[model samples]
Target: MVSKSSPHKSALKEKEGISQPESIGKNSVAQIIQFRKQQPSAQELIDGILKGDKISLSRAITLVESTQPKHLEKANEIIQACLPYSNNSVRIGITGVPGVGKSTFIEAFGRFLTAFGKKVAVLAVDPSSTISHGSILGDKTRMEELVKDENAYIRPSASGETLGGVARKTRETIILCEACGFDTIIIETVGVGQSETAVHSMVDFFLLLKISGAGDELQGIKRGIMEMADAIVINKADGDNIKKARMAKTEFNRALHLFPPKSSGWQPKVTTCSAITHDGIAEIWEMISEYLILTKDNGYFSERRKDQNQHWLLETINEQLKNHFFEHPEIKNLLEENKKAVHDNEISPFAAASILLEKYFR
Candidate 1:
């Protein structure tokens, strides 16, 4: 008996008359692997990104997201080089519950911006699966047209175990996108209605995206998120849903009025839009433009960016300290011992943590 050789199939002894050929040729596979092996240097990536090269921009962001220590140093160099070019872009953080047409709305909005020569970069952060550790949403695929646009860039990232993880990487990616000449940065965060969210702290404008019929949904959302919203866009207002959308707009506007005025002195606006029909898309941009004007004139724009910088400064410190603490060889071994000790009630959790911290410091 002869053996069958099909890369797609498990190795088996041939009993049949014929065997299928390899799905992909070995030469093709080698070429693909060789193409992927071409990684540009940090300086090259930075230079290409500054020249508005999307490939380089994406590559640099990949470095930023990598957990490897070597990648960290390169990521830092790219960020430090790009910092001066950043903070000039309009950073918008958008959030909504699942199935709210967030992707559809973004495509319409992004296309509208690019119509006027604005370079838009979208960072859609999907909730990472605890088991798979991969992004569940295909935002780039959803925003197909926008993804094809030369002026628009859509990069979806996975939200890790905590909000802080998303913040550090996404915030750094924003800098890279801005340096890549994307004037408008849209960060789509995971879930709805979290208080003092990482996205809220990093963006200049926070927009809450929602559907028309969400009465029960409102209860699930926290007031803190509503107060943080610069605008509420009720999407999918086409057909019979128009009336419900308008009603939702009115309800959101009223609810917004219930809160005290924003420090920006710019009132939060509620508007209805149909992401499918592109209705009210321009009006939404007009509203955002009004906001930008008001914030800039009142000096809130620059002040808010400064505040965000300070917040990120502290956030980075906390993240690095935590990483440093756990990465210590003594702490990793001691942590396991401490965990067992605490589980056995042989030592208090505080005492174990104290012992680990002392060892880490030493």
Candidate 2:
């Protein structure tokens, strides 16, 4: 009661002082204003990315990942310009169950490639939190050695509810990485599950990592994932696990033989590697090189990429159509009501959906 009026007046005066333009330095005020007015140009971004500028490549990727309308338009322009310079890199997709030592294997594998004067780009897709829509996993902290390598570029993207544990813009990010002179692109999916098919669709070579002593050797992995692999490597083939790893490798080789011959006609091979000891890493790479040579010599390499591009075109169209339908303001408004009606047995789900679709179409 004694000092309430004085403190109240003082707080009001302080807020007024803080809100005044003169409270900030002239240069600082101008910089803030300038930031709001500035936007990156697609041509400048394309030029810098093609020149192997990491900063530009990062910014361009952020642009493509943005869902804002203005940024989406610019992102498309940048991609269109980067397309001709893209697809120069060999894209490989890697997956495995949790605790399969994927981070360790990739770190060792990436270092091996850089040691040979190769530029490698690793794009890790982290699982997204359904509630917050933010990445739940942090991949960068796991790949310590690879993160320190000068010739390696690693970008971890949030999966954001995408079915494959891959970001919607990951394929576009690969093109940008290729334009930056990365000869090899490695896309690591969330884990060895529903996301494998998504990664397999985009990569030229699909590598599945497995660890020994997981019950039935191929215990948790789906049969479809086995058929998709070009190569299967059993990790942790060191210390006491070496014997188990070898047996697992032989088991996988037999399992792969049961499947029909792959379209490329290059039989899948099984090998064992120790990420901790860095053994058998080179042999795995040599195997990949042989597969590349065989596919390229037979013209199947380019043909596969062509088919992937066509697949992506149709996939994108489907995604856009769904986005349009769900994001429509009218549909969004009616959705809950129709859902409630169906839940209450007031209307059949099909009839409710049909009513909504009619409203949407008109």
Q: lDDT: which candidate is best?
A: 2
C-alpha lDDT of candidate 2 relative to the true structure: 0.87
**Model 2: per-residue lDDT, tens digit, 137-196?**
566789887888889989888887678776459988998899888999999888846888
TM-score for predicted model 2 compared with the true structure: 0.88
**Which prediction has the highest TM-score against the true structure?**
1
Pairs with steric clashes in candidate 2:
none
lDDT of 1 by residue, 9-108 (tens): 6666666986545765677788999999988999999999999999999899999888889999999999999999987889888888889988999999
Local distance difference test values of all predictions, in order? 0.86, 0.87
> Estimated TM-score per prediction?
0.90, 0.88
Model 2 weakest lDDT span, ten residues long: 7-16
